[model samples]
Target: MFSAPQHAVAVACLTSVIAVAPVPMRSAFAQSQFTDVSSNWAQPFIDTLAQKNIISGFPDGSFRPDQPVTRAQFAAIVRQAFKSPATRLSRPFKDVSYAYWASPAIDYAYTTGFLSGYTNGSFQPDQEIPKVQALVAIASGLKIQPVGSVDSTLLRFYDAAQIPNYAKPGVAAATQRNIPVNYPNAATLNPNQQATRADIAAYIYQALVSQGRLAPIGSNFPASQYIVQGGSLPATPSEAGTGTLAVGTELPVQLEGAEPGANLVMTVGENVETTFVVAEDVVNTRQQVVIPEGSKIVGRFQPFEVNKTLGTQFTASKLMIGNTPYTVNASSVPIAARKKSSLSIADLTGSITTLAASAALDSAISGNVRFGSLVPGIIQTGQTIGKQVIGKSDTSDEVILVEPDLMGLKLNADFEFLPGSTTAFVDPNSANLYQVDSGTKVDLAAQTDNARYVMVPGETVPVELKTGRSIYNRQNEVLVPEGSLIRGQIVPMTVNGKEGAQFVANEIVIGTQTYPITAASAGISPSSLQSLSPADFQGNVIASPEASQSLRGVSSTGEQQSGGLLGLGSLIGGSGSGKKVILFNPTSVQMEFRAPLSLNNFNN
Candidate 1:
């Protein structure tokens, strides 16, 4: 939906070009002007910003990323990058006249709190801006105020002493805002270095991320690696708290679907996963967010302290913030506080509650349930049994019956995200089972037999691995020896009753692991099968690619002989016709796992 606007790059602040290579699939320039920066550590930043229309590159196809940015140029860029309303009256700068090309830009930046003038009653617009100065400008404009002591956070930088006193707070705020992009070495702030195109691009990109306009780049990227941490974040009375929640902090939550007048009601006792959405952001005294609105709280319904009222407790086990989840000790007051429902537990869980759920839910909700069709697909969440128990992003919200003001979910213990919480969190299964990334090339075989195997449409046939393979990482180091004994099935499809066949794959197996795979082979028209006349080999075995066929002649020993199995097969095609036309198999098959298949402990 985004259209890239053509822009010309100029040199200096006015020059719009900055080149940052991408992490692939990321490019805006038809021919990259940042070609010189393919090896420049900041290309990811450049790629992101330039693509977002925040930066431009030279017309001659060069982005001098290392080029120093003058104060005036920075002001110009800032004026165009940040969207903010003016907060103060504009005043004349002694050094810049109204007619100066950068004059309006300087005033806009100054009014937006992104730039300031020297005390000598002059805006030295042409002076080269320093690293700290630029970061401060962005932090101030976005109204980010750091929490705790700025000095302590700044100490993480090796050049702590070199930071100008006035710029310290701004730099600290920027750090907490995650705006500093130090390359090669994270500890080196280089605060006094003249701001460069690359540096500014990274800062602006990071600022956007803090505002949630841009998703945070993963920590593995070079540009993301230098993002300074250890800075005290603000307990913004404007945003929430210190992005922390206290032991007793209560988050305002409601069953996700409770709209204006009606409440989502659920029958409890079945400990299926129930989800709650933060009704509003939970903020601290300073108004910094502890839990943001729309975050998920996955919980379970448990017996309420063994109460006879059948009031169940929703025990919060995990808090999903952004893409990460944290275990929490929290529980809500009784939801189904007064229900001994006539509905059976089977009435709630799906097949685990499908048909019955829809009827029972409607009956329970409005005293009657609707049945659009006795078949399937019309089964919907809140309407269908199996789906109503869990809260999904695409599904409508579900809430347990509870008083609006009384539904307080209280945290039993202090919850805080530690430094590098997101980055340090590892997938428990990252190294589990050796992984052959998607698109891994595999060689396989189907057992050859004397029996002529003929499969009609929708029929399945087994296939197996033929050779061993090794998988390697990007570093070319062997990740795992090729897993062996891979197995799966080949499915046959009639080519539109055209006397042709296309044998597509349904799944492939590796070792003892079964993975769902999808595949389709090129159509094999009858013309391709014209070579096979029944008289030539009445007793000879014939089958589709899934079954060992004549394309690879089988030896008398019954072992699959070597040859191209895809070269027009002798089996497949059934239209209630006992009369067999020379069997045809598709010429080729393309397959990939529906989900990534990673398994280990195999005999190669």
Candidate 2:
């Protein structure tokens, strides 16, 4: 195994702080110092500001680092150091009682749009600050913006997704601005974990430096030659685009069709309902027979119950997917309510595919929540049972169901060209499910070109593109076919007096090839760029990503009885011995359907 290098030593040897301007150092005087403000970690912060008289020890000669800092105390310190020029306060939160100690600071932070309150109006002032919350506050105190979309993909820590919602945006913003020096990976925000005094000092100091209020610390590293001056950085050529591919989403089409050596390959459609199981019991009034073997088990519900005791198994149950055979295992529950019960179709658990096929049978026999209203006709005393109505009822009891609908189409076009051929053209209107409407072509440039064009439309040749951003690429160069899965922020651009919306591509997968563009490229505010580090790369080498299940739709109806039959008279009478030959009567079963819908595709 490769040994890991020490981070502290690596930072010390490889990186050095840089500054835009030289800052003069100053020291605090006797009267300006606090006598009691003392803490192991607070000293570094106090010492750094002591020269400028920004902070001092308290009269008690103690900093009380472990003690939680009240909102009022923090506000006072912030006001004293970075006084806002705002003339009035905006009381945004309902719970910041006027008597609260940090009322002024809270009010100031609100008016400056640096802080917001929760749904319930209360700012528990004494609560210890969380790592992410503190980072946000520090970044807000000193403005910061990240240079590019910061991907937290590499963050391998467990519970990475546990970052609270309230602090995610702020934490991301701070990370982008590089105000928090502790972040070793993009995925691990470690928000809501307690903050230490030493950590607080480091955060504040880094925030100050990022805001252009402080000078570079000691130590010097060679200036990077790759640094580019102001204005948009010159684009570097990348062979392939980078981005995420969402499930049920369509992406860009590569000039080369998907093949064995293709750059990308699709694993399988997921989140699709593939498995299902029939619910058990409910056969008799008091003690009912449980059927051990149930109807068609589905793959979708496979995760529900593995080899555990399924309480009362079903019998004579069949698992089917269209015409394919489905494998199902059965077990019994020791409950003695119904001495010996037989399992029914409803007792089986299975995949969505199997459930769709057996929907009619299930609805007729199994009283599902969706089909409970249509009770089966009962066989009362020796004659006719429930009357069959002919005319339609006054109320709209007749329900109509629409089956799962899908739209898919492909297009092939041929254009004569040579090996260095570069071209840019709008997609022609076609009959395919995905089509493009009219839009501005101003900032729209070429995404892929002659760099790796080894084949023409109809000719076969090997092709390879370098991976990175390209010079010809624009913020609007990306194109998404209508009905394709798309997400991220929409950047507004005005071209020729017409305001148009530009969707920065976040995740795109055309056919089998996948590409994940940064949210920033999708036009989302850099401040909103959530952790998306390369370490977060979740897709296999064959595809962009993978999901656990899939969805399907089917229709069904079934019948049930309360159990009360008395037709013994007509049985011994004429040649018709109606001694209940068919113990279980059949009922009209109507099938229903359902489908899995993804939010990525706007048209779908």
Candidate 3:
């Protein structure tokens, strides 16, 4: 697989690409616990490489990332890092012998088009490898050819004159391939500088990225600003280094339909699927939303154990960020719930939990036992219980429902954004020229023509839009245009111990197109309900006791009206009659979306 002609050119290049000073890397291997990386700028890069065994710390437990690396050690590193087959004939060198520690690696590197021996037939393995030589080795081994003129590509770095004549093409190819990582300032290539351990690690990582062996690093990485894209600097400052969605980014996620610090009940060992929406926007340095609110984190809420005590935790498997779906490694804190013997169905939070727990405690429970006792999770029924309890008549604290709180989850693995994911959102000249930021609410006048529809919990009513409106940004760009109807549900809730309903818009329809929407209204109740006279509600809210029952069990599609009932809808409260029922239309209702909306052919 060796190329004879290219091998001749490579031998000429490596001999001239040399520097004076050299450092020895001879040491025993140890996992990374570098003594001096606490404040190093390249700590993130070094840590990752060390963890993967691409590089290692010295025997004394010091990485000394800034120290220079010699040619022989670099050869060993190349062997450890890459696995390509030899494509060029290997020639015997006078300086390296079969007994040499790096002799095999030297042979592999030369045969793979990575390194070359001197014209005198001697390979100076102890010479410090220069940055240009290291970069050329990676580019050549990977067969990275410059897209355009090599001279123009090299000009991005201020010290273009410092690059040697023969190595220019390979160095330019490496820059084009994003293998050159200039620290402090990307404009200076520092071609003749000695290659440090940190420098080699970063170069190899970027090479892996170019080969698609690793995910693209975040644009905001310091070294990435120097990466020449298509042979030039990024067109815009934002493109130079966008926001970093780093590993361990704590995403503040809100459980759908659940309040903060709210208690969620589940059984131990019981697995259930649930979704949580992002509570806020994860913005970049440019204030553009990366992961907007309402992005769903769907996962399994299953059993966990901590300190030998049973608990529950959420292990996320799928992350739905806008239109993109990603498999993720993330989870929430485990919560240990109170153990119990039995539980009532009505006391549960989700629908999956229905069976009684610890059925052996039936004798301890009287017929039609009250909810004084509660238990969490799926409890195997028909099992015997042997509890050493001191004579206590009241079982209120024994068998009862347990509530676990789900605040937010954390990313367990590093996540990188793919290129062009946000390019359209930031490009003004692009087809998608407008963006409606998160928390952007629109005041939509009801489109009712003197007819009202009554809606209750568990039912969705189609609220017609009037003339509607055209939403605009501060720059006077129209984001969303008029002509849309809101299909919403009257979500039942308890506000300050009083029954109320919140209008949650689930979808919006414009002409024949339907788009999913997350919008809501300030809940309305008898105590806080605002009354709009028949004339006041031009054609807003429509209500009927009969239609409310018909709309039950239906979500997006169904008739909003069973017959003509042109008036305001009544909010029925309390079961089997009691307090009072009132007819009202909630004022200050807004159709603001809970997530980011891009007008460029917006989809889910």
Candidate 4:
């Protein structure tokens, strides 16, 4: 696999004839010429290759470290790095014509087993190659063989599920040969990310070192250690440095000096920044210290849309533990108004009674009913209505406020720490600190009766979790407890000529933390007979002889009316009868959780 420096020089000379004029060709003497690569992690590898004439920089004296490396550019590098004779006959690729700039390099790479065209008989030479694909190609070209189990070796650098099927063998072989060079974090091998020009330089140089063609650099860089023989996997960022806290790591904190009714006002569509100190030392299941006590957690309330009915919803967007910024996918937290009040059933009944009494007086003046009898009946109906209203309004009259104090709020997700000496790298996959399964059940009580009045679409109402019940996972661990607050929105629906609202749960608030939850079941207890109708009022008014004759006259004419003026009185003047519409909350309500909730690292 090793090639003499003179061989690279010769290859560079040949390829320069067809090289792009914009990128100036560098001579073997012009090493470390790229200005942009001075501080790059791949600088050492780039300098070494440039000195050997195996790589060159652009005319502007820049390496363009992060620029993607196309397949054609990779082929040119392969031709200059490997001097072995072709083992197989070369065939023209459909996409690479004889006039193509890199056609010669492509043919040489294919015949020497460094690369292969796709099954479609086309070589997409201009396409950017993925990191794993580039690693596999270099390993194959150098005939590297795995010294250990392929599965186990690849798992050391990446999650098993992340390894692609086609690149498995090649990646395994590369790992054993110690030819893979990962910058930033050694443990994270971003297999599918596009390979950069800097990345290619590191891979080629490492391949050369593995074959004993180049001496390994005595550097403490993470990538350098992987190339040294028998070097222990570079210490995880945690062990080697001060340790970095991964994004999505939950930081449980307490409100330093907050009172029960403290108000935190946040406007919709604006960012609110705040800071809280860590309440306790947070450690993961791996015993890694993610955050230490007194550590500062910086956070900002992201811009959000306020639902006129649901109040203002705020979600945490920018969060930083120490100096590392995290992408937070947390649930929107609803802020409560400073002062709120609810209507009582007694109050509602009183208003209805006053209206009914006035209607009754009007009926008597219009000669619609006997004055003396109807007046006595109206008085009795009012007394009966008061008793029924009392039974329906058995709920607490307390107003609830939503105020989450972050000072002592425990983290709802795991906090993973991987510290480095100066800069820390976070594991992208580990950012999802909490996992909630599907089909979990949660029981809730309606805060306001959706059936109290005709509900309109887009209306938001409050609900609470019923007492004495807890939401549990399959392991019987409680996720949410009774008395938690939930917000529901009304979705208007009409069926069989009956119109009502379908309550959809938009969020659940536990303590100060809020999570989005879907409601699977919503039901309300049926109203009592007395609440549904003014039966006593109808009995007294319709049983009189005069009322009986009026009913018979309508009945004899085939109009089929009943209860005489009593039915008309109930329809026109009764507070509790005549097409009664129960639109808001019922006497009792139950709501079930539609999504699974996990409290893996949740603390009470």
Best by TM-score: 1
Worst 10 residues of 2 by lDDT: 546-555
Q: Which runs in model 1 stand beyond 4 Å of their true positions?
A: 1-33, 231-240, 243-263, 266-289, 292-604
Model 1 TM-score is: 0.42
Q: Which tens-of-lDDT digit does each residue in 362-458 have in candidate 4? A: 2432222234433232322232111111122112222122234432233222122222221222332364334344334444453432212222222
Local accuracy of candidate 3 as per-residue lDDT tens digits, 1-604: 0111111111211111111111122122223368876456566557665554556776566778788888887887776667666888988899888877677879989999889888999999889999999998987886666645789988888899999998898988777656777776778878899988878878887776554345545544444565545344233423322223543357777555555333344345444556767777655322335466677776655444533554555656556766666544455655555544344443332322212333223334443444344354323332211221121223333332334333346654334443443222222235854556545677655554433334443232334342256677786755566645665544443333455555556455655554444454544553312232224324444543433343232222332332423312442221222322223353345654533444444432
**What TM-score, over all chains together, does every model reach?**
0.42, 0.29, 0.36, 0.34
Clashes of each: 23, 114, 31, 21
Model 4 global lDDT (CA atoms, 0 to 1)? 0.48
Ranking under lDDT, best-scoring first? Answer: 3, 1, 4, 2
Instruction: List where candidate 3 sits over 4 angstroms from the true fold.
Output: 1-70, 77-97, 104-128, 136-156, 159-186, 192-250, 257-263, 280-294, 306-309, 339-408, 416-604
What order do candidates take by TM-score, descending?
1, 3, 4, 2
TM-score of 3: 0.36
Per-model lDDT = 0.52, 0.28, 0.54, 0.48
After the best TM-score superposition of candidate 2, give how far the Cα of residue 509 lies from its true spot, in angstroms. 47
| Predicted structure with the largest lDDT when compared to the true one | 3
Measured by C-alpha RMSD in angstroms, how accurate is candidate 3? Answer: 26.3
lDDT of 1 by residue, 1-604 (tens): 0111233222322111111212233432223447666767677777666665567776666777888777877876776566665767888889998877777778888888888888898988668888988898998887667666788888889998999998888888777766788876889999899888888888887776565445556645556677776446544323332444544478777555444222333443333445677778776422457677877776555433222334445556567776776555565555543322332232222222223233444444321222322235222343422233332221212223444346667754445553443212222266645554533444323233222333333434443432234556565756434443333333332343454443333334445444333222333334322344433234333444322333323222332222222332332221212333334221123332211344453554
Candidate 2 ranges beyond 4 A from true positions? 1-42, 50-53, 83-89, 92-100, 141-143, 153-160, 181-189, 219-604
